[model samples]
Each structure stands twice: as C-alpha cells, then as structure tokens.
Target: MEQPVHHFSELFEQLGLPSDAASIERFISRNSPLPPNMSLSEAPCWNEGQAELLREAVQEDADWAEVVDHLDASMHKQQ
Candidate 1:
C-alpha cells in the first residue's frame, strides 16, 4: 500500500494558492531565501489555516510531505 505522490502545483492548490508554474515560480522568488532559523509553517506568509496544513503535512509525513519538503528547500535556497 503505497502512499500517493503529490506535486508542487497540487500542494499549492491544496493551500488555496495559485498553482500555475509561473505563479509558483513568482511566489517562490518573492518569498524565498527563508531565514535559516525559520520553518516553513512559521513563515509570516501563511495564514492560520495554511500554516496548520503545512505543519500537519510534515508532522504526519503525509503524501504531501515530499512536496512540502521540496518547497521548504526551495524557499531556503539563496537567490
């Protein structure tokens, strides 16, 4: 019983964000270089609901976790 894999666009959609490639890239560029001390869920960019969803995805290691981790890394990358 393998868990379903999720993509970045799907995760963005789940979070009620723009899921298109260009929009996703713009979002990452705008909000990226996340401070080394900060977690994705702790970023000021997220609302309460979005934060909770991010927290759960990581904590529970859900199908969304991989993409979430990818997002975390992407945000942390220096522009």
Candidate 2:
C-alpha cells in the first residue's frame, strides 16, 4: 500500500503554492478564518486552479487530506 505524505510543505506544493516558511505562513494567515459561512470552495482567496486542487484533495481522501481538512475547518471557524 502507498503511504500518504503528511507534510504541510507537500500540501502547499500540491496546491501549486509556495512551500517556503514565510510563504506558507503568509498563505495560512491570509486565507484562514474565511468569511462567515463561506465554504472552502467559496473562499475568494483561492484561484480557480488552487480551489480545484483543494476540493480534489478533500474529496479524494488523497495524501493531502489531513492538511486540507484542517484548512477547511479553520476557514469555517467562527470569528
């Protein structure tokens, strides 16, 4: 069986975003705590390609699932 990679940098790369420390921190802070009631797919922060990759990662239970799930939850948390 194939093992899933659980690295945050891996997830960032999969999403076509920068995986460097500063870039990762900036991405998380900018996109998280998304607008109230906004789903991950509905967040205005993601480009179409990024959003599609995220949706696939969550729905497919892919290697990036854990990070994507965390992101989804974090984005939905109440302000």
Q: Which candidate achieves the best lDDT against the true structure?
A: 1
Q: Per-residue lDDT for 1-79 in model 2, tens only? A: 9866577777778778899888977776776778766678778888899888888887887877788887777667654
> Any runs in candidate 2 off by more than 4 Å, and if so which?
76-79
Residue pairs in steric clash, candidate 1?
Answer: none
> What TM-score would you give candidate 2 relative to the actual structure?
0.75
lDDT per model, in order?
0.95, 0.78
Question: lDDT (0-100) at residue 8 of candidate 1?
Answer: 92
Model 1 ranges with Cα > 4 A deviation: none
lDDT of 2 at 16: 80
lDDT for model 2: 0.78
Candidate 1 per-residue C-alpha lDDT over 1-79 given as tens digits, one digit per residue, 9 for 90 to 100: 9899898999999999999999999999999899999999998889999999999999998889999999999999999
